[model samples]
Target: MVKELDEKIGALPDHVGWRLWRASRAWQAEFSAAMRAAGHAWFSEARAGLLGHIPRNGTRQSALIERSATSKQAVQQLLDGLEAEGVLERFPDPRDGRGKLVRYTRKGLDALRDGDRIKLEIERDYIDRIGRERFAALMDALRSLDAGPADASEEASVPE
Candidate 1:
């Protein structure tokens, strides 16, 4: 078992993972609030997160499942909910007759304009909260982490 972290630090024993999780939740919360204010009444953090993974032109449902790095059931449920809410719809994939393509509905496309506006507003607010350089560095760091898929056996090359 890992030893308890030094109490003075005021963080969990697995500080790095905890910090990342905390930060992600905070950012998602802020985004969700902004989305709700932008008149997307069907918006939830999970729905919004899945929506972010989708491309404007749309993609195969299987591709979305892969891109979101989540279970098929979870992705399907989210898609169904969004479809019921009229935010998105599913269509037959042209190239792959066996697969389905998911895309935003016309109403969804209209709301996407508001979503785009809200994203910039939220990004600007984040930049104001944590300076432009720091925010840029944070995004760069995250992108670096996300750039490649890593196996569980490979430890992240976190340099000293």
Candidate 2:
């Protein structure tokens, strides 16, 4: 699958292909560092916004765990820790009293904004390094890829 994908994209010059690969890794690392520097104790914050992308009212902890790609125990630990820090508040789900709904406090929102700012700065740095035209082209390519179907077998074949 990788060979096939490579062949498809191989129409580009060799240096461009190599540069794209390197830029992908650089952006991934930049985002990872930005997430860490945001001082979000939970990996959930790293995954999405303060309130999370999942619907708070209807979602379960298991759902959050699955969606966030974290273990249930890890998610619980993070939730507890964040609650202790007053970053998130958990309330009884109005729809399901037995279930809890998690949402961010003002502090959590502020922290998320800080993380977004860091991400923006990283992106700006990349644009400055690569120039706006190249950056825009790269973004377009990324969006195209993102809109494509997920190929699990192909993804599994890739070496980490």
- Which tens-of-lDDT digit does each residue in 1-160 have in candidate 1? 2354555556647677788999889878887887787788899988877997888888889999998999999999999999999989998888888999999888788778887787788789889999999999988888777655666345656432
True lDDT of residue 147, candidate 1: 50
The digit string of per-residue lDDT tens for model 2 on 1-160 reads 9999998886765686698788767766676667666675453434443245445333565567777777777788777877787867778877788878777787777766776687789889979999999989978877656555675444444211
The segments of candidate 1 whose C-alpha lies over 4 angstroms from its true place after superposition are 1-14, 148-160
Model 2 poorest 10 in a row by lDDT: 151-160
The model with the greatest lDDT is: 1
Poorly placed runs, candidate 2 (over 4 Å) = 1-60, 150-160
For residue 62, model 2's alpha carbon misses the true position, in angstroms, by: 3.9
The true-versus-predicted C-alpha distance at residue 13 of model 2, in Å, is 16
What's the CA RMSD for each of the models?
6.2, 9.5
Please, what is the whole-model Cα lDDT of each candidate in the order they appear? 0.84, 0.68
- What are the models' TM-scores? 0.73, 0.61
